[model samples]
Target: MKNIYKGLILSLLVLGVGLAGCSNDDNNPSPDGKDYASLDDKLDYSLARNEVDFLMETYEKDADRKYHDAELPTKFTEEQNVFMQNALTINLNHSAPVVVLPMLRGIDGNGEKVYYIITEASDFKMAKKLGVNYSPKLKYARGSEGVQKATVNGDGYMVFEGSVDFSPVRRIEPGTGEFAFPPSVAQPGAVGDENYSPIVVLPSNLVLNATPVKNVTGLHDRIPEGERSLDLDEMWVTLQILDGFQGGRAYYYHLVTDAYDQVPATIELGIYAPKLGKIPQFGQSTLDEESALLGFSPVGNGIDDLQSDNRQGLSSAILSDQNGSGSLAPLDPINVFPIEPQNELEKNNNYSPLWDAHISKWTDEAIEKGYQRRITSFQDLKSLVDKGWVVSFTPDAGPVNSYVAGLNASNAIINCPVIAHPKN
Candidate 1:
């Protein structure tokens, strides 16, 4: 009897040990299941806003390091950082622009959870806050079938679990005080999209300038939630890419963008919008209703409220190759369409759209300075040198003379001031 009882106890202990080992195997993850080496503790996503806060902090760090790098454009400093951080830390996502870069897996908006982090920080960490606002938020994919699991982050600091898509985020420009934008937004849409363009430029001389861009008041009295548009008189820039371009080196044209209705339209004038960065679009022109130009179309919807005061803006660039060949050619009516190769200026044919009044005034000034004869268009401005006038072309550091030249009482115009040949 004693032997039988001892044997039974031993057998039961063995069975218990086997069962515990099997359970452990099923519950524990395999080595290949995770890449925890580069992972930080999975974001402390225990609270409602915690996820957003964490992301915001992460982006703040990235942008701070990126822009403040001593060797680079060291444009934003510590003080500016504070201003940017505060401005960007927002309860209202629509009124501000935000961009997000995630290291998460299986959660992306259009593609690999990444974006071009364009921002302006005077210190409030605008870029980071923006990233948090725009990046993945755990939302349900518009249409989901049953039994579907929505996990925002397959890994740390990752995705917006519920939905694969969300609203489009606007690209932030420090100079432009604009906020939210739709994703399908056309290329030139934000940068002076003839339709939804903002007022970015103002004239150097006010006499001939157009009114700055403005918004229609009483359009429902107040702006709705999730609508991020700029307020009038705020300095902003138009972001654009021309028809032919490689990569997204977007051009930033600065403007006050408020005039039109206010301009006591004495005569139609050009508005001056300066470039804050490199203007990637090589050649430029103001299109007439009948002409086709490669650049932005002047056609837009909110002309009633937002108006660009056409005046000359200030810009400068070194013209690479200047083969002084005195030549006069007829304006190709075909240029009525956008810039095609055939319409490219012949070797010495330089032309810009300028008001007759402006040309007459400048020509008179040169004559007053004891010049032999007057030059005609902007190309003529360059030709003054060969014709015996001091046709001086100097590399400039600040604004384009167009500020003075383009300014009308209501407008300013900044056409291509630089005839730079592409640097190889």
Candidate 2:
């Protein structure tokens, strides 16, 4: 019996050693294969990124064909002329590049021309002096930072390019938490998943010239915020359309920022896509309007401590002076079913009647008080509603406001929806 136990232990040890050998062999492949130790070796070692590389190559080819006519200037003088022509049309006021020319051959090798485009006949004449024929107008549309999310596309690719303005850095601060629908809002009814979109928080611009963050685990997570000394000015953001528009809207990221500080900021600018209408900038006002329109319902038993009873369900009530005679009436509570054992997996799921109740209350309020529109720009999302339809993007200070008020107020120190409600 002792010998048998010893044999069994020996067999297990041998198996473990064999497995370790296989793992080591997998981790350290031949020189021809991916080298896990070297960043340079892994830079081009991606099967999935091959598609993106192909897309990028295809984009450069298309750009060259569209602008460069698939040819580089033969002479240095011609290259200089092309460079200067591109430099003239640069719109410095915009936070992003509207038009950019690929590298122009220079005595010092390939060099980029900033804000360079031939916008007029005179600019062409100037280029003609150097014996180069340049286009008088831009060949590509000046919008679209589309992102492709679909696995396959039978349709040809559609590209988008947009200039994001982070000049208002205060508005795009992180932790502002004003990008998407407030999660605290009660969602007890039949709300489709398509209706909610990720509100990404990103720096208003990429610090391409900032000092790079070291020891990044993956390329996807790294932010090369150029030099630490330079302020984050602008970022080149690109979005692509996929699956012929059914895939989703062109809102590329939830947020973009270069600020290293831990403060929360939000991206409140508008995104334009054919299917998404104008991506409305969601703000505190919108949250309040949504809450009122949603009739303040309690979130699923407070996010913390799931085992506790859903006492927070009581906060869903909407108190108001219905008759306008100074006497207020509180609406009845929406009963939330206890989190059943079978539904334990979906514990975080919202089960409040808040959304439906708010919709009902909003319709009634709109009918009783009529809706009003307060025209505002993307820069200012403050809403202008007192009790009825809050049309503006300003922050709301209602009694039944959610944490958005506190977060937005805190981030106030610094710092979307379309008509066709998107699916989950």
| TM-score versus the correct structure, for each prediction | 0.19, 0.19
**How displaced is residue 273 in candidate 1, in Å?**
24
Mark the regions of model 1 whose C-alpha exceeds 4 Å error after superposition: 1-46, 56-83, 86-107, 116-154, 158-424
Candidate 1 lDDT at 289 equals 16
Model 2 Cα lDDT, one tens digit per residue, 1-424: 9657534533432222221222221332422232224211111112112222232233344344322222343322321212222221222211121212222110100111111111111012222332222211100101112111111011112111211221221221111132222222221111101211111101111000101111111110112221331211221212111000111221111111111111111111112112111112112223212111111111211112213322122122211112212122212122211111111111122111111111111223443553422112121112222333332122242233232211112111110100011122
- Tens digit of lDDT per residue, candidate 1, span 1-424? 9657534533432222221222221243211232222321111112212222333434444444222222233232432221112222212121222211121122322233321112211111222333211101001111111112122221223221122111112111111112111111111101211221111110100001111121221111011221233222222212111111111111111112211221101011112122211221112223221111122112111111111211111100000001111011111000011111211222221122111111112233444574422122344433443344432121131222231122111122222111111112
lDDT, candidate 2, at 398: 26
Report how far off residue 258 is in candidate 1 (Å): 19
lDDT agreement of model 1 with the native: 0.20
